[model samples]
Target: MLWFPTLSKSGFRSFIADNDEGSTGKWMVPIPVPDIGLIWEEIEDAAVEGRILAAKKSTHELVRIIGHNLACVYCSASDPDTVAETLRTLREIGVDGELKYKSDLATFDGREEYLYSSSEFETLLPRP
Candidate 1:
């Protein structure tokens, strides 16, 4: 299955460096957006129901990607203890104002930090 390159080449290079252990296979493979789009349905599971609205931090001068992908929201939900909770969880995750977070380097720091960095004895300052 194809996945979007959500980071820049150099950015992705760094991502590969930092994430080498978690993944395996070719370290670098660049594909154009149109080419990647060819396998959209397979990667995102497009076709069962509602479309997929991806909120990834874009690369290649793009923003969020909307695909025809659909999944059993029940299957993808994190805390799917009950039918109703599972159904409503992701269905309204975007509009409900419920914030879920993951531990990534950038998220740990403010957005401003990701754009610039300084290593003057381990202190990072704002670039304003």
Candidate 2:
């Protein structure tokens, strides 16, 4: 499962994608926006199970889960400390991966917009 974070009027939004073949046969699942604690709990759980592929923040930060090649894009506005803490936890749990920032902010204004990140980070997502 992959968790993609985005922002909404209510709060943070996480869209989960079950990538297993024949599992629900859906591309993504929209889950209820939980508080930061719950979000981290979920991440920890996924990490323990070794099922997380990637995680993204709405602030344009992306975390790619090593080996799995899963890319998670976070789209919610978050404080630096929160971001740092999350990354630290991931690292402590042995979820090795690189953190990437969006390269072109202007290109992310709409759903049709293609996501482009810095050269340091590679994305499985295609460029528009």
Candidate 3:
């Protein structure tokens, strides 16, 4: 995997134009959106159907990712059990949400996968 500190459409074009498929099995372009978290009100006390809706609403982005890539987003109030339920529910509805302990990443397309980073010191660079 090639992690670019910054990328642009032209940069992506340059990447695709490169002739080094042997070096990089796949390329991943990360798009990080800030200040967005899935909040589920009364998810624990809700019924199965309610939890389904809660899970779907909370993890809707997992299914909507475009292209061959993954996404790492934050979900508020995501306990282990809740996260498990969300993953299960997402699978039931034909979506994929994975849980990496000491981690936080999810992939929609099957091409490239990125594990959630467990780093405290991180930076988000601009991309276009």
Candidate 4:
């Protein structure tokens, strides 16, 4: 899933609540955006195209359009080829950023669950 650094902790929690289907076994695979920031126009365009692809190719909804920076894609039941195509389009538009991954704990349903960490996500700098 694509996650914007600007999202507050509450906002992030809200996103999880909205997207999760009460599945305790789920993991948050957050792909962070680096400090260079994204090309918003390109991202918006890609999201529209992705939505179109999801409509024809996915059994479940894939694209979640919040804004240029807040969009998320739920790829659980989507076609890999379509996801690849969307990624390729991002690369073609020079929308590149380093993705960070970390594991942390969160509470869901009164039970502790593992969630990929997003600490310092907004401070990520481009690799030198």
lDDT of 4 by residue, 1-128 (tens): 33333212122222223223322121122222432554544454544554312111111123234212223322222223333443444445554553222111123345343332223332342332
Across 1-128, the per-residue lDDT of candidate 2 in tens digits comes to: 33344322334333322221111111111222333334445553643454433343322121233322233423322233333343444444433434443212222322333222133222322333
Considering every candidate listed, which one attains the maximal lDDT?
2
As a TM-score, model 2 comes out at 0.31
Model 4 residue pairs with clashes: none
Q: Write the per-residue lDDT of candidate 1 for residues 24-47, one digit (tens) a residue.
A: 111011223454443323322322
Residues 13-123 of candidate 3: C-alpha lDDT, one tens digit per residue = 111212222111111113223312212222222323343322112133442454222322222223344334434443333332223312221222233443332121112
Residue 126 in candidate 2, Cα distance off native in Å: 35
Better of 1 and 2 by TM-score: 2
- The window of 10 residues in a row where model 1 has the poorest summed lDDT is 20-29
Which ten residues in a row are the worst by lDDT in model 3?
Answer: 20-29
* Model 4 accuracy (lDDT, Cα): 0.31
Candidate 1 pairs with clashing backbones: 46-69
